[model samples]
Target: MGILNQAVQLAIMVGTIRTLSWPSANESRNANPPEKAVHRQIGSDFDYLMLTRIFPTAVCRADDDSVPDSCEIPTDTPEWSIHGLWPNFKNGSYPQFCDGSPRKFDSDLIKSIEGRLLRMWPNLYPAKTAHSFWKHEWEKHGTCSQNHKNLSSELLYFRTTMAIDTEYSVGSALERAGIIPRSEPYHLEDIRDGLMKELSHGMHVQLNCLTDKKTRQILLGDVRMCIDKSFQPIDCPRSNAFQPATYFTGHSAPLPSFKECPPLVTYLLETSTEPSHMLGLGHREFAYWINPLIPFYTGFFSQQKLKHELLWGITVPFMAVAIFIYVEGGRGG
Candidate 1:
């Protein structure tokens, strides 16, 4: 009986250790299936938050078909502006339209900074309401980050986002590195190196591109950067999964050819007076879907799912069984 009791304790300890040591499925596997992707109460699920900023000119260029006249351009100076600040796991799977949060998005909550948000985070299409873009961002991404005090409420989330956006301007960084809007194409590596030089502190960015189907030319689209829970920049995790669409409308049937940028990319201004050296392209809407539950890292999870789930499912049960056997054996003795 004494031996059995010792064995039970040892088993519990081992189980606990394994649970702690095991890499989280959230951080290893592709995202859980859409149905099971409920927002867990904000603990250990996310590694860092991603700040996705887009080139307005490129976005406008892509939207030529849907609302060509509606595409908003930053005229004062060309700038890369906020797309959304998403809570991302290390593996790249992110929870969207998070469940169980009663907090509804209120435009009034962020009235104090509406002016700033307009300049920094406007919905590229002017046909949408002033708060339309912001509301979607809050519900789809900001809600998942409520656990942090700095981002606990809708107001704080937008405010915090603006503060971060101001601190880190991808356009400024690129310009400092001498990579600005130009008709000539740039080597993708040079763009990466330029960003690294300007946004130092071990900064890393993921560059996405808009592909012109007509010419098959790649245009610089957006740059995604990661920040830890405390909001310090961190190297983004690698994943080649299909990211969620930025627009509220369901993905277009003939989706705009937006994908990872190729080796050479054109960083031309959409409003450029010069005749476009490349053919014009159609746009993908950037609105919020009522329930855009798509996972950004689809292919990344399949490989690690079985191992992570099996071990996690067994850990607690095995420990319980060990304790029960020990108790029963002591009684028999």
Candidate 2:
């Protein structure tokens, strides 16, 4: 009885799958032409985040292979070296951001000064600007004396209003574009919320516009891979929530459900009163359907293991149905 039932289910799945036309060679070619043929925006919120945060952090940490338990420098250190020197000092130069008195010192002393400045200022200067500052400092301070002509020059250059204005201008641009929002901003929660909201909206638009099934699938798989690779592991209680529209609205709808009646159907039934019932799936249904496919949508489940479980749970069933159908069709024929 089990074998017969399985065969029947398989046949049904095969029939449904066959009814959905796969893209032909010509159609496939037409759907995805050369990059020049299709006009695509080269940027996204994720790209912005990567350019602003991930990439910079990666570059900063790359210099130091060791992973510290905390980002905070010890009290004695007085400065944390991110990519190069202290925050106040430019990259590749000694620090000179002393108090009222300019401390004249050799390369080693400069290094210590830079370290102290880093602890004090943290992110006082951008990496690039800091590098330039260091260059000037090196040239000016290579020669030192009690009169301290080199120290005087370095101090004068740092204290100049033009340099300060330039740094502020650059930092302001980064902040405006939602890069480095602030040097020492206290609103990490706000930043994360804004980033996630922007990412969700961007992903939705991109996935929605992708009409080619193979391309869409490939893109989705790539997205899932990224999520798996990037996030860390954590433990938490699981929720059985699902969205209907993103799943049932597309070619995936006709597949047999693992559940007797999918949550999607219930969601649809609830919102059936609307006039545009068939125009597109309801929000709940859409959310239910797309939720499994979009890793970003599962923001609450930040843990890596939960993410994998959610993805595997959705995909395994769907793929199993597909495989069963393909195998059954061969036997029947």
Best by lDDT: 1
Residue 141 of model 1 has an lDDT of: 82
Q: Rate the local accuracy (lDDT) of all candidates.
A: 0.64, 0.26
Candidate 1 segments whose C-alpha is farther than 4 A from its true place: 1-44, 65-70, 74-78, 99-102, 212-216, 240-242, 248-257, 270-333
Q: What is the TM-score of each candidate against the true structure?
A: 0.67, 0.19
lDDT of 1: 0.64
Pairs in steric clash, model 1: 29-301, 30-300, 30-301, 62-282, 62-283, 63-283, 247-286, 247-287, 248-287, 248-288
Q: Tell me how candidate 2 scores on lDDT.
A: 0.26
Q: Give the TM-score of candidate 1.
A: 0.67
Across 1-333, the per-residue lDDT of candidate 2 in tens digits comes to 999999999999987765443333344235423221211111100101000111121112112212222111223321112211111111111112232223332333345345544443233223223334344333322222112222234333233222222332322332443644222322333332333343322121111011111111110100000111111111111221111111112222222112112111111111222111122233444445555855663454455457677867766886675445433332110
Deviation of model 1 at 163, angstroms? 0.9
lDDT of 1 by residue, 230-250 (tens): 888888765534464456233
Judge candidate 1 at residue 281 and give its lDDT: 13
Q: Which ten residues in a row have the lowest lDDT in candidate 2?
A: 217-226
User: Could you tell me the lDDT of residue 217 within candidate 2?
Assistant: 11
